[model samples]
Target chain A: MASAERIGIRSDRDILLARQRGRELGRSVGFVATDLTLIATAISELARNIVLYAREGVIELRVVTEDSHRGLVIVARDHGPGIVDVNRAMQDGYSTSGGLGLGLPGVKRLMDGFEIHSRAGRGTTVQIAKWLRT
Target chain B: MDVPVLKQGPFLIATVQSALTDADLAQMRRLLIEQVGKFRSRGVIVDVTAVDVLDSYACRTLRDIAHMTGFRGAATVIVGIHPELAFTMVQLGLSLEGVATALDLEEGLAYLNARTRPTIARGNSPRNSAGPPRNGTHTRGKR
Candidate 1:
């Protein structure tokens, strides 16, 4: 397995970079075209959130294998003004940025596993994974 | 990268050559809206065949472009969304609600042509008699 790749996210350009890298990584893990799109879209949402809410963050991508299944893992970490209410943030159509409010919820729908940790002032971290289909 | 917006008769075609950042998209939106009014275009087509991903921001920007251009009496059509990208966009719950979409540039032009035909037939097109003649020859001849 290749070592994890890390992309620093600060602006909209970083969001695109992270998404491209995520798509490449997912493709290398044998993800189909549709699945790769999903992974890339999920990465875009996470990276954009970091840029919008945290100002700066890092997205880490890795390939993992467990037993017979191979998967891709993505971790987004940022130290910025974090979410005050995690539950509300997770809800669909709940955005504080005047957006469509589909960022977090959309990311959750795209990935197989999702986890987010945030504090009012401590920043935020989101980890998500997608397993390759046999 | 800057998207090239070409004037096609009473329509404007903005072809996105690659993945555009948020700022680039915003700029494209402004450019499209401005050109639509300046040229008195009856329709606008955004060709995204080269774009590999259309995220929420991109989708929102496209929607805005459509809405703003509509105010100028021009229809907006987005074309060349990949099949995979479409699937993922739906899964992400992202939608271009008011924006028109088609399979490719040709289809987008076809849609726009059909959409604007009624206005042209009614002689309600923004093009005035003092402007270039409305003959069919000038449609594809202009930049």
Candidate 2:
């Protein structure tokens, strides 16, 4: 899936803009209200993760179609302190810092597909996809 | 800048103007607690009618604000959560247990009124007798 839209997640304003863009693209892909929320909320979660942990990142949303399955794909990339324990990060209520640990796991539950790549000191990237008929 | 606050009798109504970032969220929390204290209000209505998305951070901020205000003896009610946004928030594993929700601003005010003095009984059936809801227009019948 090629990049349909690219958003830089640097500040609070960028996160907001990313949400708006994600919502629009979701709508363009014929996602209903709940699915739209899923798309936009996922983007916000990823962007906020960057701002909170890495301090900056990039969000890429793409339109993907395979056979008869059509879905929207979102990729969030951040170049900050990467996650040392990917499996632990995916667990519910397992936040590195002292807060409700619902960010990554929540995203995984919302999307139809999810993948995470990270390094200890390099960066991290999260990719998620939501289908229309699912 | 602080989120806009409108004083209504003993209740303070804070309409979130737009999607908030981390810094703005912190600032808004400070201002809201301060306003709640300064007004000595009994209830606070956080109208999130203009917001399009409620992320994890936003949900946490709202919950924290509710807790802090509750510490100050003010009841907080969140009003006008876009239906889609609400559905998604719940799906994202956000319960928002500390904060209460209403259909619109009017209902939020009425909810606070009903809970504050505990004298006038509130209406059970929701009418939603107001203009169109703001922001994405996803205000459905009830929560």
DockQ of 2: 0.55
Q: List, residue by residue over A1-134, the lDDT tens digit for candidate 1.
A: 45479999999999989988888888888998888888988898899889888899999999999899899999999999899999999999999999899999899999999999998899999999999988
Model 2 misplaced stretches (Cα beyond 4 Å): A1-3, B118-143
Question: In every candidate, how many clashes are there?
Answer: 0, 0
User: How do the residues A14-112 of candidate 2 rate in per-residue lDDT, one tens digit apiece?
Assistant: 988898888888888889888888888898888888888999889998988988999899999998999999999999999987768999999998899
Per-residue lDDT over B4-104 for candidate 1, one digit per residue giving the tens place of the 0 to 100 score: 99998999999999889999999999999999979999999999889888889899999999999999889999999989888888989989998899999
Candidate 2 lDDT tens digits, B1-143 = 46888998999998888777778888888888998989898888888888878888888889988999999989999898988888888889988896888999989988887788533223221332254444544333343
Worst 10 residues of 1 chain A by lDDT: A1-10
Interface RMSD of 2: 1.4
lDDT of 1: 0.89
**Alpha-carbon lDDT, every model:** 0.89, 0.85
Q: TM-score of chain A for candidate 1?
A: 0.95
